[model samples]
Target: MSPTPSHSASRLLILITAGFGLALGAQAASHDDEHASGAHGAASSQEEPKVIAKDSLKQKMAAGKAAAKAEKSDPKAEPTSVSMAELRDLIDQKIAEVRAKQAAAPAVKVVNKSPKPRAVAMSGQVKQSMAAYGAAAVPGLPAGHDLHWEYTGTAGPQSWGQLKPEFKTCSSGTRQSPIDIRDGIKVQLEPIQFDYRPTPFRVIDNGHTVQVNLDPGNNITVSGRRYELVQFHFHRPSEERINGRQYDMVAHLVHKDAQGRLAVVAVLLDQGKEHPMVQLVWNSLPLEKEIEQASPVMLDMNLMLPEQRQYYTYMGSLTTPPCTEGVLWLVLKQPATLSPYQLSVFSRLYANNARPVQSASGRMIKEGQ
Candidate 1:
């Protein structure tokens, strides 16, 4: 309101000039701040080391994959093939060890076997041969006659045959007898000298025959050999073939020498008078049956001899079964007399115990000429 136009113009010019100078100062200060901040940031970035890509990421990844594949391809890295070969070798070694152990064990052995025995067979020719041998083996038995005993029933002829299988002939042979002694060639002979004496006597009812035992002193001399008498046995229906005749009863005198050789003398008995020897045996007869014991009495054996010494001699088998050969037979030509009572006593025990005559069967029957 107070100043003129020219003054106002000069004042405006001054204000404008002041304003322009203030603006210039402010812009300069802002520029300094910006430059300071930018320098600090650059210094911090330079303090820390910067990372630069020397190799490509793709190349690094490819190298790692290649190393893994190599590991997989190497045979030593895995146990698959080695483990299988080692296991097979171990198994084979174990098998070899087992075989060796078996081979080291002990060996075994075996035992032996044994053999069997044979049996005997008999025949008719065998029987005849046996009979002939028996007759020849016995020293005093008579020839041309077969002497034997009979067995039957409870008192049968089978027992005698069974005593020795050789005696089988007694049971089987035919021509056995209890005949009448009627036919005989007339021949002169020495009278039997009887030396009858009493000694200890024993009687045995042997299953086959009634055996009378005498002491060792009793004996008979024939063909210059003195044979000690041992026992006497009876055969019913005497088994002697006298001129082909058989008798009712026959007595056998069994004797043994020191050498154990046997001689049997046979005597025929007929019904007549009381014989001294028969009487003695009957008087001492034991009550017990099938008993083989002796009584305390002396027995006289000479009394059992026949009145005549003339005899028929032959080789023969025992008239019993299994008729063994090798017995010498002697049959006195003369017969001894027995009373009815004596005959009855013998008959009571064994009525008709007799063996039939066997075939002389090409055997030589000789008379004591």
Candidate 2:
């Protein structure tokens, strides 16, 4: 049936109003869905970056707060869109880059602080015994009680006797070494019978002088006693004098007998020819003091002696400690020549190792033929 115009209009208006309400509800729902998706994406992006950018935690937190404030101020603004997975990947990449940079940084250096090495000093049984024998005789010192002596200062030759009771003889002994041979008793004495042989030698810088220890082969007969050579050493500015004249250097060949008697032969050194043996010894000098160095090369003691074997004989004490008396001394009359260079080597080590001439004390010096 055909309806009236008013009825038709009312029905049409009702339909139109219902459709409009439905359309408005659909639009509101769509907006809500879009806002929810954007919020979820923003949360995911913020959380991933916070976890990955832990190295810059403070900066990330500040940026996230600023974005949240902007979103709150403009609710209708297209909710800031972000890809969660892409944000996570970017954060990880930045973290890896930061770690690589840290690893490539230069390392810190540490300085070493340690003490420097000191010079070596003489310490041996033979050296100790020799030092004890160097001074004037005294009450035997307690065993192993080593005393230190030097060329100058308090422990020098002048104060040796006072350094220890064992060195008393240095001050009281009548027959001392390095006497001035001003006037010798012109008696035809027996010549020194040298039985020196070629043998290996071990040298040592014993703080006082350069001492050479030889294999047991050399021997010398003086007066009625046969002495076996044990070792020899040097002293700068010949210890023994001839008519009050001092030479460049002197070598003392120390020897012992079956009865333990000591004998020393002094070969005075003068400035002249180059001595091969002296050069060898100087070349082999140890870099550090008190150290010993041995050579396999055979050395002949006779080669060190001068062609003229005439000598001056006397009863004296050891030039160095416990200046023990009764030592047989043979000071060669003619001096052996040593090149100036060789002399300088010894002088650098010991500028003046010679002890001053002791008082002759009315002792007789015999001149040998």
Per-prediction count of colliding residue pairs? 51, 10
Residues 1-369, candidate 1, lDDT per residue (tens digit)?
334433533443344334433443444445555666665665544322211121222243344345445545776754433333343344345446645654654321111211111112233343244332222222232221343333445424546555545456556554322222333334544333333467787665544556676666776666566666666778777877565666678888766555445567788898888898677787767576544455666776667776567886656655554454555566787889888888888888777656655566456555654
Model 1: which ten-residue window has the lowest total lDDT?
110-119
Can you write out model 2's per-residue Cα lDDT over 42-157, one digit (the tens) per residue? 44444443333343443443444455455557746442312222333444555466456546544311112122221112223334445554311122222223558777888889
TM-score of each: 0.50, 0.62
Worst 10 residues of 2 by lDDT: 111-120
Question: RMSDs, each prediction?
Answer: 47.7, 28.8
* Winning candidate number (lDDT): 2
How well does candidate 1 score on lDDT at residue 208? 50
Off by over 4 Å in 2: 1-145
